[model samples]
Target chain A: MSETMKAAIFVKPGEMTVREVPKARIEQVGDAVVRVVRACVCGSDLWYFRGLSAHPHNSQIGHEAIGVVDEVADAVTSVRPGDFVVLPFPYSCGTCPVCRAGFESVCPHGGYFGASQAEYVRVPEADGTVVKVPGSPEDYDDETLASLLTIADVMSTGYHAAVSAEVRPGDTAVVMGDGAVGLCGVLSARMLGAGRIIAMSRHEDRAALAREFGATDIVAERDQAAVDRVLSMTGGYGADAVLECVGSRQSFDTALGLIRRGGVIGRVGLPHDVEISAEGTFYGNIGIKGGPAPVRHYDLEAGLLDAVLERRIDPGRVFTGIYDLDQIQAAYEAMDRREVIKSLIRF
Target chain B: MSETMKAAIFVKPGEMTVREVPKARIEQVGDAVVRVVRACVCGSDLWYFRGLSAHPHNSQIGHEAIGVVDEVADAVTSVRPGDFVVLPFPYSCGTCPVCRAGFESVCPHGGYFGASQAEYVRVPEADGTVVKVPGSPEDYDDETLASLLTIADVMSTGYHAAVSAEVRPGDTAVVMGDGAVGLCGVLSARMLGAGRIIAMSRHEDRAALAREFGATDIVAERDQAAVDRVLSMTGGYGADAVLECVGSRQSFDTALGLIRRGGVIGRVGLPHDVEISAEGTFYGNIGIKGGPAPVRHYDLEAGLLDAVLERRIDPGRVFTGIYDLDQIQAAYEAMDRREVIKSLIRF
Candidate 1:
């Protein structure tokens, strides 16, 4: 193993530099050293780089990945050398009250890895956070594994939105975004047995993917017109459930407007601020369920690893752009310019 | 029967005049003439008298009452002459789609009676809107029936708020406001098996009755302090459910602050124009459920009639003041001065 690993480091906001840094080592008792097989960029990561977030400068960058367990501490019993696993974005001890209640993402003592976007990562609580991939071909393939990376964050987030929305069988759901998370919401709604899935998007390319993911209808319009279209499609009763994948006020209003008198609205977008009218929500009998997506609760990394090995849901299609670790700045720029759905960093 | 009956008419806002008006005759196919034994003023009726509502001048003055069927139209088959019945505040046709879905109060064709505050009231959709009191004595009684009149409006409204709040057995509920609706909320919470009921009140008299009606705790304070007290009583987790019975901004904010995470906040008060913060509701996972109370949906009038006959719930305690038919202005004055929880007019 090399003493140094290449990493895409953010020296400051809007600045990314490829540097050879000392490889991550097992720092805690339950830590496991994994050789990163693949890592991807997320919309939230861009927030930090674009100076929109309060994240400290030079902080570790990415939070999504799939890797092999190259080393484990004495206290770690879940994985060993040569085992393939996916890391949950939020590293949870998996033994807190919130975790026991199935809300792991909000674990009181959880944090994330990939602070430096490196070739290798040290995962804390390895036994509790990493899920092993079964029946893997010995060779690590980027395409197959890239999809698994989504399970670590965005995919699980979409699942959270569906769960919060309480999407039941025979329900109609409207997803209000065309981002990766929104696309995953379309898939989640289908998996949850929503009879009708409406994806609200103006992007033709993304809308096509949403349809492939089982969207029964695509609302190309935005705002009030989009809400009207959704109501028109649902026999004037509005959708039974709405997923506010975009946290903007406009998206929230659309979700609220498209839901029926007794429907649920689940939100997962990290907006700067969102406000709802009491009169409107109360008069319409609308209920809202959302907060931070409890990614740890769904244990997506573990579940997706098994699902991926068994050829269930494909998440790799979300990755529309890829770049070498040194080209991290260009990746962020492309994503910001809406040139790609998502960008990935290759070691 | 006499060709005319004593009635109270609102000549203008804040003034009422009593005169001999022709006894109501059966005009609609389903209309039934009821000889009113008792009728009471409602808080909502005050809005019309104060010119805050769009009610026409000289319209009927009351909507809550217990009466006997004096005459029945050919189409009315549910009740016969001399049958003791309770009239639901809002008359529902009971066959509309909204009514069939258990939202009778919001029925498109539903309307209220007692436009003249008359001794003989005409009820529409008699077969569907009036419920006869079972096992009642042959002689008509006013006091006992007056207590049951609460179910026609305020009691039903309170029950709706509690139901919307999802008040379940062993849950703690906080009721905002000390009005008749708030008192009814205390009883409704008890009926719903709430583990603890906290009634917010500033009036000592109302607070006393609140306890009698089953409020386990009383927070006489208002605003933030009241919210803190409610939270303190619930071990800092906030109540499991909260009923916003007041329409003011302060009441709404207090209700919002008293509910726990993932808790329900049911609001039944009609607000003029209040801006509810969507971000505040979304980030906490709070669920809001409520609109206008479906008083006609749950057979409230029937239930109350039976309760009155059985001496189960006493609604008459709400009436603290009474006046002759011609003294309607005094009744309103007393209510405005907070000298009475409710007022009644006698001919």
Candidate 2:
């Protein structure tokens, strides 16, 4: 086997490079090393790429991946070598209080994967973090593999939005962003039994996808206009639940204005400079439930993988552009310019 | 038969006077005139007394009362003259979308009972706002009347905190204030099936009341000490639900620190200059649900009145002082000095 691997490393603002790096090895009793099959870019990555947020120079990049396990330490009992697995964005000790409570993403002992966008990656807490696929990666078609990759992040995140909002059967729900997560939020709301789904998107392509994902209405307006449109659509009562996929001040303000008096806002966009007034939420009996998506919980505990294998949801459509490991820069650039909804990296 | 009556008027900060004013009468088709039987000074009333919040120079003061229906417009059918009723702080139109959804406090057509502290109060949307007691106020003893008076505000507000927190059976709950509402929150958490109740209070009198109201433990420490104590008590996992009866920034901070991952904070103290970071909440999968308590919903719709009459809960114990209408100034002064948990005015 080769002692070196191709990996993407963060160089600085607006730059990432693919270079030959040391192959991942089992470093702890709980660690496992996997040869990457697929990985993808995330919207949050743009925060650092645009210099809106800082990224450490020369750090291993990427957090989402699916691969075939090549090595596992003795303590890693969940998966063995040659096993196909999908990694949740963050690794967790499944026995921790937080993971036990189904909030694995925030487990104190857990953290993000830093080298998933590489030929070989080391996974800590492997027994608790990675979900084993039913069969080898080659058994799945390209579309199915793409869909499985979503289970690592976006799809689970969208489902978290719906779950957090407490979307009820036959209730009106709204999605506040037109990105991959927002589109997936529409799909999740539908699966959760929302009777009427409204997707607020200005992009035609995204809007069409939202409709396909079960949105009953499309709102192209922005800010207060969007709030007014939703209110008008719901007979001035507003939606019962709102999925805030864009963690912007304007998005939160719009959410505050466009929900029914007793509604909730499920925010999963990784907030950027967002401050919510306690007084503002108190008057409306509004609820705010959000955070990092517990992808491991959704994938293993909530049967998300089963739903995917059954073809119940095809979230891979968000992967509009595919690239080889060498095209890492182009992938980030295309997503930053909104040229593609998301970019998938094939190993 | 009286054309004029004495009402407490807000003269300025630290000054309230009983002055002769026109007696309350039907002002709208949905109005009812309530002859005050018992009214109380609330913690919120102290906000203006301390000059911390603004009030009109001579507006009728107070928002909580239990009274006998003196007169009603022809269109008011819920209560008739001579019927005893508990006035929820806000009067809401039952038909409004907000009211239908059980949030009467923020109904578009609802408002506070400004003259509730007076000899008579003109209640608008009476049918939707007042919950009729089985008989006249004379039929119940002083203790029952005092408890019923609490159904108007504090007790219901406390219940809102527990309900908002989604306290479940066997869960450990924390109450963040030692005021009447927080004490009642202890009772509410117990009623909601929380196995362990921790009250964060400093005063001996309030702590005693909290225990009587079903607090299993009390943490007299403030700020970080309180947070640390709670974390230690719950095996370092923190409480499952925290009732934020104090809407200060410090209380919210403490709540954020002491809640277990996936836990919730139910705040109902009428937030004063409080702000929550969305990023902070998102990481822990924390949820915030709060607002003005929907008293009418709890009283009529949820059978809180039944619980009071059945003696299942006696929240009246929070009334540590009682005074005649003529002693209004002393009532406010005693409460302002923290000499009483709550002061009741008997008319």
Candidate 3:
């Protein structure tokens, strides 16, 4: 085993570099070292790279990945060396109160894995953090593998949005954003039995993928125009549930405009400068609910892994571009340019 | 009956005068004129009186009341003349889409009853707007009548808060105001099976009433101190659900600080100047759901009317002071001075 391994390192705004770094080891009683098999860029990663938000220079940059367990500490028993696993972004002590309440992402004993986009990643609380796959990495094909990778973040996030919105069986669900999460939101709404899934996207490619994922309608408009179009379509009643995937003020406002009285908004995008006035929401009887995806909770609840493994959804189609460790910078650049819906990096 | 009757009129900021105004009569096909038997001042009414918010000069005031049906249009059949009833603040058509969804408060065809404190109130959509109390006013005692009056607004609003917060058995529920609505919220939480109900109050009288309303604990501290006390009380985990009965920024912020991860906030107070950041709520996996109470929904669903009639709750005790129509100004002043938790006006 090598003492050093290649990893993606944040250099500065708009740049990430792949270089050899110290290999991860079992540092705690419950730690496990997983050799990366797949990793992906998140929309939030683009935000950090664009400096819309700050990121520490030289910090390990990724938070989603799938890998094979290389080692586990003596106290870790959930998985063993050679076991294939899916790593949720946040490492949590699943026994904590927050975790017990199905919010492991915000568990007091949990923290993010900022270094998942690397050759080897140290997973703390391994017994609670790494989800063991039924077989080794080769047990699934490339598409299945990519779909499994999404269970770490985007897909689960989309599912969370749908769940938070309380999407009903015959609801008219409006999804804002054309990104991977939004497409998955379409899939999730469909999975949850939404009668009408409307995808708000201008990009033809993303819109098509959204349809494939289960969008019954597509509105290529933005802001108030989109709101008008949707309201007109629904007899001026607006949607029953709105999945807000873009966390900008405008997106939030658009969401507010696109819901019927007593409708709900499930917001999954990490909000950037959005302020919801309680008075503004009072008259409409609007309900706002969502947060960072508790991917682990879903994994344990309904099994996103099983859904992918069983081919119930083909979310891997979101990876319009793929790359290797050497092409890390290009992956970020391609996604930043919107040249790809998402970039999946192979180990 | 006289063509004119005494009513409370909003003369201007800080002045509400009782004067002879034209008595209400059936104005629409769905209308019913109710002779006021009992009416009360709401905290929001105080807000209107204090000029914190605008109300047209010389306009009719008051929305909570119980009365006898004086007359009903040919199109109305829910209640006949001489039938006792509780009038919800908003008069909604029974069949509107929003009304059918249980949010009659924001029904497009619905509107406020600004003249309820007067001699007679013309309730539109009488079949839907007026909840028949089974018999005439003489059948119930004064306490039951007062509690029935609360069903028109405060009690239902408080119950909506608990329902929105998704209060569960064995959960710690926090009520964020000491006013009538908050007191009712404490009672509502207990009704919903909350094992621990914490009422945030500093007033000795209100605190005692909160205890009587099933508040197992009381935190007189405000802001950070209150948050700290609650955190310590629950082993620094905070309450599972927070009912925000005060819509001020401080109250909302305190509610945020007092909830555990995955906790929810149910806000019913008419929000003043509160702005909630999506970013602030995202990290905690928090949920917010509340609006103007769908009082009619509660009335139709679990029968808040039945709850009062059955003595399952004694929310009428929230009326700490009572007055006649001539003391209308004094009723407002008493609540403003914190000398009374709430005031009821007898016709």
Candidate 4:
């Protein structure tokens, strides 16, 4: 293996470049070096690429990926070299009190994944964060790989929203956003047995995807009009639960407006310019529950991975565009231009 | 009985007055006339009295009271004339979707008590809204009356906070504020079996009441110090749930700071100038869940009134000052001056 490999680096706002970087190695007792097989651009990456987030820290851009374990630290017991693995973004020690509570995203030693469209990536707390995919990495088809990749971030995030909102069977659930996370939220609500899934999508292509993902209705309206639409659909009452996949104030407002009394808003999107006032939340008797997605190792523990592996759920349809490592920048540009819902990069 | 009675009306900002209004009579089929026996000033009422809330519509002041049934319309089946009852503030038809969902505070037909520190009140939806005390109006003494009165608003609101946060037994809880609701929260948390109930009270008298109410610890510190104290107590992990009884931004911030990952902040206080940003809430995996207390018919349904009657929780101590109805304005002044945590006016 080459000592240096090509990896995507977020140099500054609105900029990401691919260059040969030092290959990853098992640096800690519970670490593993995984050779990248599939990686994807996330909706949140737009926060940096669009100058909404601060300039890059480490610059290795992508945080969601599927790979094969190339090396493993001696103490890592969960997986072995040559095993296919899904690297969850927020890597952490599995035993922390916060992680034990199933909020591993905010674990004690929590940090981002450096899987950034790279040839190789070092995964910390491998025993807890690296979810081994069944069979070899090469054995999985492209659709399965893409579906599993969603679990690493957006799919699990959407699932977290559904779970956080406590979407029981036969619930009227509204997913606010047209992005991958929102589409995945529609899929998740269906998987969670939601009776009616309303996708708040204004775009044609995204709306089509939302419907395909099992959205019963498409609310193309915005603001209070959108609220009225959902209320109208649900017999002048709003949804029993809302999945806020868009973290902006408007999306939050839509989520708040979408829920009936006693409903919960499963907030997954990274919040920006949004303030949940007590006046807005309390009077409606609405509950705000959810934060970042607790992907929880993005493994069998979440059940979605197993669903993807089995025939239970097929979330692969969310990947509207696909590319190779060499086309990393173009893939991001395509996402930035709204030319792709999400692009999967094959290594 | 006289055809007219004296009642308090909010005349203007910073001013309230007593007026000889027509004694209430059952107007709605589901209505009952209640002669006010014991009425108390609420912390939220202070918002109107202190000119923080807009000038009132009905001008009827007090919303928390224990009263006597003077008359009942044909359809009212819950109580008859001379029966003692607690008039929970937000009188609503219990069968409305919002009410049936247990959020009567915002019920469709919901309106203020019309209790207004008055001698008589007309309670609409009496069958669904009023709770008959275990005995006649003459049965309970001053202490029990005061304690039961707390349940109509503050105590139930406080309990709602604990419930909204899903405060299970053996969990650590924090109560913010030294007002009646905050003190009630401390007591309610105790009743809920919270292992450690921390009362954030800087006032010596209120803190004493909090401690008497079963607060395991009292953190008189403000801001970060208070948060640090709770964190230090809980091994730097913060409480499992927080009861926010102070609606200011600082109190909301304190409540957010006091909860660990997966903890809920049951926000019961009437919010003022407080906006809980998603940025502040989501990262901690924290949830925001309270609103105005539903009061749940103010009794056996709420479980707290029964708790009070059973002598398991004594919230009467929250009534630091007492007066007769003739001294209503003076009572309001004293409460406004912060000379009393809460004051009860006997008719």
Better by lDDT, candidate 4 or 1: 4
lDDT of 3 at B66: 92
Write candidate 2's Cα lDDT for B1-347 as tens digits: 56998898878889888999999888899999999999999999999988999888888899999999999998998789999999999899988767887889878788777778999999999998999999898899999999999999999999999989989888899999999999989999999999999999889999999999999999999889988999999888899899999888888899999999888899998888787878778888899998899999988887789999999999999999999888888899999999999999999
For candidate 4, the docking band is medium
Top candidate, metric DockQ: 3
For each candidate, what is the lDDT? 0.77, 0.91, 0.90, 0.83
lDDT, candidate 2, A36-155, per-residue tens: 999999998888888898888887889899999999999988899999999999899988777887888988888988778999889999988999998899899999999999999999
- Cα displacement (Å) at residue A155, model 2: 1.1
lDDT of 3 by residue, B83-194 (tens): 9999999888878667777888888788888788998888999987888888799999999999999999999999999998989999999999999999999999999999
Runs in model 2 lying further than 4 Å from the true structure: none
User: Model 4: runs farther than 4 Å from truth?
Assistant: A9-17, A50-54, A74-77, A138-141, A297-302, A337-339, B9-19, B48-59, B74-83, B133-135, B139-143, B297-302, B333-340
Clash pairs (backbone) in predicted model 2: A291-B282
Specify the poorest-scoring 10-residue window by lDDT in model 1 chain B.
B297-306
* Candidate 1 off by > 4 Å: A1-39, A44-59, A62-153, A163-169, A191-193, A271-275, A298-327, A330-334, A337-340, A343-347, B1-39, B46-59, B62-148, B191-193, B297-335, B343-347
Best of the two (1, 3) by DockQ = 3
- For every prediction, compared with the true complex, DockQ reads 0.30, 0.71, 0.72, 0.58
Docking class of 3: medium
Judged by DockQ relative to the true structure, which candidate is superior, 2 or 4? 2
